[model samples]
Every structure is written in C-alpha cells, then in structure tokens.
Target chain A: MRVNRPKDGDPISVALNAQERHVTFDASRGAEAPPELVQLLTPEGERVEHPAYDIDLTPEEVRGLYRDLVLVRRVDMEAVALQRQGELGIWASLLGQEAAQIGSGRALTDADMAFPTYREHGVAWCRGVDPVNLLGLFRGVNHGGWDPAEHNFHLYTIVIGSQTLHAVGYAMGIQRDGADAATIVYFGDGATSQGDVNESFIWASVFNAPVVFFCQNNQWAISEPLEKQSRIPLYRRASGFGFPGIRVDGNDVFACLAVTRQALKNAREGQGPTLIEAFTYRMGAHTTSDDPTRYRVAGELEAWKLKDPIERVKAYMFKNQLADQDFFDSIEAEAADLGRDVRKRCLEMPDPHPLEIFEHVYSEPHALLTEEREQYAAYLASFEGGER
Target chain B: MTTLTLAKAINEGLRTAMEDDSKVLIMGEDVGKLGGVFRVTDGLQKDFGESRVIDTPLAESGIIGTAIGLALRGYRPVCEIQFDGFVFPAADQIITQLAKMPLRSLGKIKLPVVVRIPCGGGIGAVEHHSESPEAYFTHTGGLRVVACSNPVDGYHMIQQAIRCDDPVIFFEPKRRYWDKAEVERGAAPLAFDRAQIVRPGTDVTVLTYGPMVKTCLEAAAAVEQDGRSLEVIDLRSLNPLDTEMVFESVRRTGRCVVAHEAPVFSGLGAELAARITEACFYSLEAPVLRAGGFSTPYPPSRLEDHYLPDLDRVLDAVDRTFAF
Candidate 1:
C-alpha cells in the first residue's frame, strides 16, 4: 500500500529558499520608490506622517539640526582637504551620511553610550568630541586622541562589525546595574555579514538587553554594493533574530531623528534590540585613498544629489522661515572659522616620541616589555646621531 | 590549613575575589546553572546571583567580546572557555581586541580581563578538549600568560590574575584539577609571574608547567632512584619565562630538558631552549633537549598518551641529554 505523505516545507528549508532570492535597490525606480521605509520627510523637503514614529521639532531645534549638518559637512570637507595636503595620512569622509549620524547621535540621553566605527565624524560632533581631536588618528599621532569614557562614546574600532558585540555587552552591564540606560552601536551595511555582528544580535535578543543597532546602509561598503552583502533587506535580517527592524530615509534629517528617538526610547524602556537601517548613499569615495570612479558610475552620484542630507534640512529651514539671511551668514562664518581652526590644529599636531610606542603595552610593568624597551633603546642608539 | 583540589581552589579563589570587589563578574558557557563542564564554577551562581555569574550562549567569541565590554564598564571580568580547543573561536576577541585594546587606546582604557582556559592532555577526553595553546597567547605582546600546576598556586594565581589591570590568560591544567594539597587560605598571594622550584636537585634541570609539571616531578623521582639527582622548576608564567630562575637552574645543573603537553615545534619549549642556549652557552652540558608532543593535531583519546609527554618520555629526554 502506498502511503500518502504531505509535501510541506521545513522552516529551515523555507528560510534558506527565501534567502536565495535577490534583494536590491532598483535605481530605475529611484530612491523614493523603496517600500516600507518609515520616512517623516521626503527629498523635496515636504513633511510626511508615519503611524509609528513622529516628532514635533521647534523652530530653534530645527535650526540647530541644520547648523549641525552644515558644520559636520564642513569639518568633513576640511579633513579631506587636509588629507590631500599631506597633513593627514588618511580621512574617512562622512559626506552624505551626516543626518544618519547626527540624528541617531542626538537621540541619546546622558545615560546612553555609543560604540562607533572609524567613519563617524558627524556622530563625534554630536557627542561633543572636538573636531581637531579626531584628526590625531588620521594624522598618525594617536589611535584615538580623546577619552572615550568622558564622552560616553568609545574609541573608533577599525575592524569592522566588532563594536556591535561590545555595545550589547555594555547593554547587558546596564541591565545588571538595574539602570535604564540604552546602548547604540554604529556600523555599515557590509558589517551585516560579519559573525560578530550576528552574534551580537543573538546575544542581545537572548538576554533581552537594551541596544539599538544603527546601520548606515550607504549603498556601498568600500567597493562592494548592497547587493553583494545581502539577498534580503538588511533590516529584514533582524526579524530572523527575533527583533523588530525598521528602515528610514537616511537623507531626511527629520525622519532619522524621529525613528532613532523612538528606537532609543524603546531600548531604555526594557525593549530588546532594534535594528534601524538608515537607507542612504555614500556620496564620495570610501576614504581619501579610495578611487570610487573605478567601481561606480557618476550618474549614480548625480541621482543621489537630489537627496542630499544637508541640503534637505537647509531647504526645510528656509521654507519654514526659521532663520533670516543674518542667521545663514553667521553660520557660514562659523563654518569657515571651524575649517581654518581644524586645519591649523591638524598641522600643528606634534608627532609622538619614538619611545612612546612602548609606553602602554600593559598597564602593569612586564619584564618582557621592559627588556624589549631596553633592546629597542639600544638599537636606536646604534643608529648614526641617534640617542637613547 | 585545609586540603583542596586545584579545581575547588580556583572556585574558592573566584568566590573570594568576587566577595572582595562588587565589580568582579564570572561569565561563560555553562558557568551558571550547569556550574561548568568541570564544575570549577560550581555553586557560584547560586551564591552570587545570575547577574554576577552569567550563563552565556554557546558562543565563545560572544563571551570574550562581551567580557571586553564589561571590562570597559569598570568591571573586572573573569571569562571561562569550556575547554582548550574552544578558545580558537574567541581568538580574535582575545588576541586582536582584548590584548591590544589598552595599547590601541594608548592607555586611556584598561581591560582587567582574565580568560581562564583549562588546557593540556592527560585525561582520556575528546580531541579538542585537550590542547596547550598558550604559545599563541604568549607571543602576543599586550597579554599576560600564567599557568597553575598545584592547588596552592591555583588558589592565589587566579585571584592575582583577576586583580591585575592587564589582560591575563590563566591556563589551568584540567588533568590535575582533582589532585589535592594542603593550602593556607590566609597566606599572602604569591607573585603570579615567578617560577618556583618544587623539587630541587643539582645534576639536571627539568623545566615544565601546568599538567606536565606532575609528570616531570615523577620523572625526577624516578631518575633519583637511578642515582641521578634532577632539579624540577615549574614555570608558573609562560610569557615572562622567569628567565632568571631558568638560567640559574641551568647554570647549576649544566643540563636542561623542557617538557610540555604541546607540540615541540615552535612550542614554549623551543623559545626556552633558544633563550637558555643563548644565555648559558658556556654552561651547557648538552644541547637543550625537549620532551613534548609530536608536531601534529592533538590526536584521539586512544593515541593521546603516546602523543603526550609522560614519565617515560621525560626520562628518555633526560637520558638523551646525558648521551650528548
């Protein structure tokens, strides 16, 4: 007798088959056509409504966000110019991702902490880190110039996706302390594929730790596009880890602020991790050393220019009559001063002493470290005109 | 004075450290409700509460990565890797992040993290469970590596490692966990970096640490019966090497044999032999002989005894030095 067997898909097989389907942003349909994005404002500086996230910013607060965007851009431009002038070894310019960084960075309370990647200059501005202090890393003077604990922002982690785990752990610590603090971690779309990031998702979900994963999906991770990293939307990947995921218009400052504020609120209120995919584009090369022209088309950049993160905020400020020409002129003058000040400070940055390399290998005195220091000192003295 | 096994001593040490400081924590896989695979963290969770003794998911990298974060939050974290072989998954966090974080931050942050790994072979356990991966950590600059061969050392070394500001890789010999000795619980903590001569002699110097310390001690006893007095030095710290003690012992004996459970090629033995030869060239009775496992993956339980350095193997290397 032939037994009838039901042909049903197992959860694992179904998930794997679904993952095989390709997910990409269709340039032909344009950036505005992407579905399920919780956008509070459009590229044309028009206000929109979202059922989940909403914000009512005062005229003064709106102007402050605009100033932040413009000055962050100015600092980024100065860093790029400094790199070109050989004042810095390299600079990771956050040209188009300003709103994504500032919005999320500004949403945090004093109790909240942030773990950032190396390309978070805008977030550093929001965190009150001096722009010149950031130049020390790119200028090869120090790994990170300022104290991370003082600013509640950790030092920049260069190894991609590693900081996410640290953020979850810190969040766990907050839970242990019975505090209402939340933790936010910044990474790019490329970091989604990293094991540490995925592990962080699992740890946060299982522990129900308060954390917000803010990923700036800037369309390009170095040379690889979003298509190369994921077959599904990066936010959708969060659902598999048993958490809510949201996408926002990274170019719209209003949308970013509203979404991040809600996410941080949810985290502080004992909600587990939330993944916010800031759908933006990298408007410049990956870094000062990268040549994006070799990999991307100029037309793509032209298309994204209509959705400039800083320009939209500026348009909103002008359309709403929040500031007059005097306000604009003062901001421009302030930006110019900032640029000149950063350049001067970057050039005046003193080189660290050669022996400083052995200063902090260990917090305690190690016999091996002492021996190596002595050996290195002797070797340096052996050089012509070199002294120990 | 009370007698305690090495495993129990370590547990007591952890309990004491946690009692001393409210900021100290213990986190790892199976460390909580399950107590731990070897029961080294037994009853810790019941006493300290789940927040202090955490039972993490079965992810080695996550355990270490989070420990670094907790350390940054001004907490002293002691992480336990279930076995020696499982430490590889967390190598990036340990070697790249935990090890170099202080130096990378230029001393702006201090990571007081202790990664406790139960290493070496002797028990008929599965393959990955028994390995001596200390050399990989010792070679890394920003990490402090130490091992415990006996109960008293285990008791003090663990607390010392937790109190140290630097990241320390504390290797506990799993095979000797059950071995007991009388310990003075109120005695001052021993310096975690120095080597100690457990059994002194004048004819030959046998250098070993962790699990192999007992094997070398047995070999020393056997060689004494054969009218050969053998000096045994337990190298408590692998990174620092305790070169002064090693050099002094070798200078007195004029013959040396380094034994360990790890493979001979590029192992801790190789570094000790090279440094000893360079320092005591004129004091050499024979080229420094090494008794250790073959340069291969840790074999199956059936073949581990053959691969591991035992009493016979140590004596054979000692005899070879005499032949030279």
Candidate 2:
C-alpha cells in the first residue's frame, strides 16, 4: 500500500489521494517480521539457533519465562478490564509486547537501572515494584506510586521520548561512579521522531555512556504505523548515530533475553550504547482509550497472535513435556487470584486529602506555600461543617 | 574581601560549589573549554577536569533531559542554556520534566539541578541573546526561580542555588556581567530566597531584580535631586517572591514601581505589582507602576535602548506613582 497520511489537499491532489486514503488494514504481510530478526524460539514451538545471539535455557528457566509472560499478560488484562469498569483512569496494555518487556526487563542485574515509558508493566513487574503501584498512577491517586531509587525503575514517563535522555544521563552517572552497571530505557517506534531521542543517541555515543536504547517497534504508535516513524528499519537507524543496531524477534522471549543481556554486558564493559529494536506487534489498542479499529487492520491482530510471546513458550514447554496439565492449571489459578487482588486493592485505594496538594511541590519550605496552605485550611474551615 | 566582576564571581562560585560537592557537574555548550559565552564558567574545566565540567553537544533539551537523569542517579548537575532565548528548545524538559519531577516522585527524589541562563538586554548582542524569560519559569510551579544582580550576590547566590535541593532556574543579567563589586569570600552567604532592600528610602518603593536592580538604584540617585527618596529593593528570588519584604517597604513608601528588562505585559513585574497592590491596598497611596520593555520582542541591539527600561523610564514610573 502506498503511504498516505490523511490530508486536505487541492482538488487534483485530493482526487489522487482519495482512493489510497481509504486504508484497509492488511496484516497479510504478517506485519513485516524482519528477515534479519534474531529468533531463538520459532512460532510453532521449535528452538532455533542464531549465529551471534543464543542462550541455553534450562527447561525450568523456559517455564519460568512462560510464567512471567503469562502473569504479566494476565495483569495487563486485569488493568484493561478495570479501565473498562472505571476502576482505572486508563491502562496501557502490554499485551503482545510481554516478551519484549519481560525478557529485556529480566536481563538487568540488580545494580542496573531502568527508565520506562508508561507501558512497561512487564518491566515494572521484573523490577520488584508492586503491580498495585502502577495502578495508583493509572487510578489518579498519585503522579508516580513508587520511589525510583527503591526499585531502580524510574517512574513511567508519559511524555513521548523524554525518558531516553534521562537513561543516558543515569548511565553517565554510573560511569562517573566507577560502577559496573548500565541503564536501559524503554521507548517506542514513534518516539524516534523526537529530537530528544536523537540527541540522546548523540549523547550516548559521544560520552561513551553505558546505556541501552530498547525500542519496541510494536507496529503502531497510537494510530501511525511503522512507516510513519521511520523510512529505514528502526534498528539500522542506530548505525548513523555510530552504534551497533540489532533487530531481535520481540515475541520470542529467548531472543529478547539473550540480546538484552549482551547489550547490557557491552554497556558495562565500556562499549557505549546499543539500540535494540524489538520487532513485535501491539496485539491490542495502544491504551484503553485508543481504538485500533479506527486505523489498523483486524487481520494484523490475528497474524501477531500466532507468534504470541506466551503461546510459543507454552508450545515449547508442552512439546518438551516441561510440565503437565496441573502446572498450567496452577498458573491460571494464580493469575485469577492476582486479578481479584488487584481489583480489590485498586478499589480500596483512597483519595488523598485536598491539602496534600501543598505537599511535595518543594522539598524545602517556601513562604508562599506556608501562607497558601494555611489560608486554604482556614478557608476550608470557614465552609459549613468544613465540607459536605 | 576581594573585588571581582559579576561573571568572575559566578565562575568562582561555581568553582567553590564543585569543590564542595563531587556530585555537582557543570554541563553546557563551550562551558568546558571556552568557559561560556560571557565567561561565567571560566577556567572550570581546567581545575575540575573534563568529567565534572562537561561540554555537551549543542542541544538544550538534551542538556536538561540528561541532567534530570543524572539528578535521579544522585548527581547534582548544573546545566547551562547557552542563551536566554535558546531555553525554549529545552522548555519541555524544564517545564514538563525538571519542574515536576520532584512532585511526580512525591519527594522521594530531590533534583538539586541548577539551569543557568544569561538574560536581559544592553550588551548590544543580537536578538535572542538579550531577553528576560523569568516570568515563564516563575509562573511554573515546583521550580525555584532566582536572579543575581551584583558580584556579591552572584558569588554567594550561585553557591546557594547549587546547595538548594529544589531545581532552580538561575538567571544572570548579561548586561551586569562586567559590573564589579566587593565579595567577602569567607563570609556566610545570605539565604537564597530573601529579598534585600539595597538602598533605604521613604518615598516611592521601586522593586526590581537582575539587570534592572542597578537601573532602579541609579533612578533612586537621579530622583534624589528632586528631594525624593526611592526605596530600591532587589528581589533576588522571583518565584517565592519576597512580597512580605516588598509589602513592608511599599506600606511605608505608600507608592510603588516595578522595573525589569522583560516585557511589561504579563512579566514578573506584573505579578509583583498585583501582589503589592493586593497586600498593601489600604496603605498604598497609588497604584503600582511598572517600568519595563515594550510588549514587542527584544529588538535589534541599536533599538534595545528604547525597548529596555532605563533610569529615566524608571524615574518616570516613580514620578507617575507620586502624581497618583
């Protein structure tokens, strides 16, 4: 299909554009899973080998990855259901991109740090942050629900491409501290358009900062497709910035794990930055508020489900007799319990007192806040019975 | 006691801050080798080495964005936006990220990052080089905004801002760079946010900051011939404006005038005028008058004299306040 962005044009041009602007979603190309895609596990339960990147996973480890992928997806589904039921303001589902998040997320050593764009729920799970903490931000109870220093997982940045520079800066700090640790930042295909991301690429390269740029090219950034974000492949774009760029099979959990571990190792070894383009698909809408039906083809979702990050792992486990029906049943029961617990805890979360607005704006006391807080308290008191 | 130019004092202050805290880093374009356009960070890289004194690629947003990350990693990064007008490129980082990062983290983090921008007109520099954009920052919450007018404050205030746990937008008047004054190096510095009454008087209270502090002081001396005493208050801190101190002066003087190189329309002067009028309403004998640049953008260097607030323009405001 010809690339046609919706535009109001002159009569002659409008006539030329009208037919192609009638965009029919075509996932028939199977959504362009790259030929160069580094895959360890194939779609139908086969363990494949890659020349450069490969990991020897024990059956238990493979099952463990499957558990992570399943649980993360389950948590994401719970959040989505909560959003539909008005329990959450919004939820950015990590549906098809679970392996991309969990694999890369699990690759980080305890000393390394992470900076995430708002959708890295799987990453947050790997970082030891309570899944409920993520809900608080979605529930509007707080801006961010956990301390970055506590988890080494910085708060989810809502602004597109803003966190990439922060990641590089954190890496530079680690470099200065003489620590053998790296920083990983999660952004999407669309964020590559932002000047800050490009600048971060320059910074990461020039400073020889120990950082990894993990871009999950999940096919769509809200409504725009991959073609809108870049002309060249997202990974290859890193070459111009003087860094090694690799395209990993984002759905294959093993590839994500192996590639990320190698990238982080290279970073800690003082080899500067690596851009890992995790080739995957957004199986669901961007957020609860988004409608993929409006801009995407339905068959695209179907095509990606075949290469689902969790299913392939499950298939591999079953083929290898990694577990019996009891194991699958147990995981399902655990997922159900987690969903119920999340819903209950989210509903129980209380609204902060109005006066809490005066808090945290400044770490130190300011005369303006002192007066504003006091005067606001008195004003509230002056009301009938303080409040209704 | 030693006499140093405002630029030199800031350079010394930065040097002192770097010595005091190993985590404090200085990053900007040309800050490492060139020592900055106005030499405010002169000789810093030579002493602190390249690690602490960083000459980043010429991108304002990148400079601040990385600084935020550094601050998150427990490093105090002082970023420099090469010029006043260039800060808008990083406004997303400064406004969306730097200003709100602390509140977003619910005080779990402290960003002791300082963004230094050389501001104001009168250096005969080109457009964008001479603009006072303090109002934009002061209007934003969660960011502490400050400007130092003279060498003493320049020396001590830079250190104070560095020590401040909040993200501070520190403005240095470009015109006042060469202005020299005595700085008692070892003396304990005044608090960062306190407003000082530079010259005491009982006539009209003229409140100003940064570049205009000197102008207001000059206006006070110029109006002294008319047997009028103008109380000049240099509001060192703009965001948590020392309005209480201004109220004290304005209540006594009964008239007020606010001056700055920034445009009079919706400038920091407007906020000062409104606050002073509101608090000292009954005590104020006249409405607060503002003397500042025109609403237009900072004009060419040749036309800056007319656009910027001069001693005569300030005196005119002081005279108008009396007439009221």
Best by DockQ: 2
Cα-based lDDT at residue A360, candidate 1: 86
lDDT of 2 by residue, A37-144 (tens): 799999887999889988988878877888888888988999999999998999999999999999999999989999999999999999998898899889999999
Most TM-score-accurate candidate: 2
Instruction: Tell me how far the alpha carbon of residue A263 in candidate 2 is from the true structure, in angstroms, after superposition.
Output: 0.3
- For residue B241, model 1's alpha carbon misses the true position, in angstroms, by 2.4
Please provide TM-scores, in order, for all candidate models, with all chains considered together.
0.95, 0.96
lDDT of 1 by residue, A231-298 (tens): 56788878899999988989888888888888888888888889999999999899999999999999
Fraction of true interface contacts that also occur in model 1 = 0.61
Model 2 ranges off by over 4 Å: A1-35
Which stretches in model 1 have alpha-carbon errors above 4 Å?
A: A1-34, A382-385
Cα lDDT, model 2, residue B169: 98
Q: Among all windows of ten consecutive residues in candidate 2 chain B, which has the lowest summed lDDT?
A: B269-278
As for candidate 1, its clashing pairs are: none
Per-residue CA lDDT of model 1 for B8-47, tens digit only, reads 9999999999999999999999999888998999999999
lDDT of 2 by residue, B113-157 (tens): 999999998989887899899999998999999999999999999
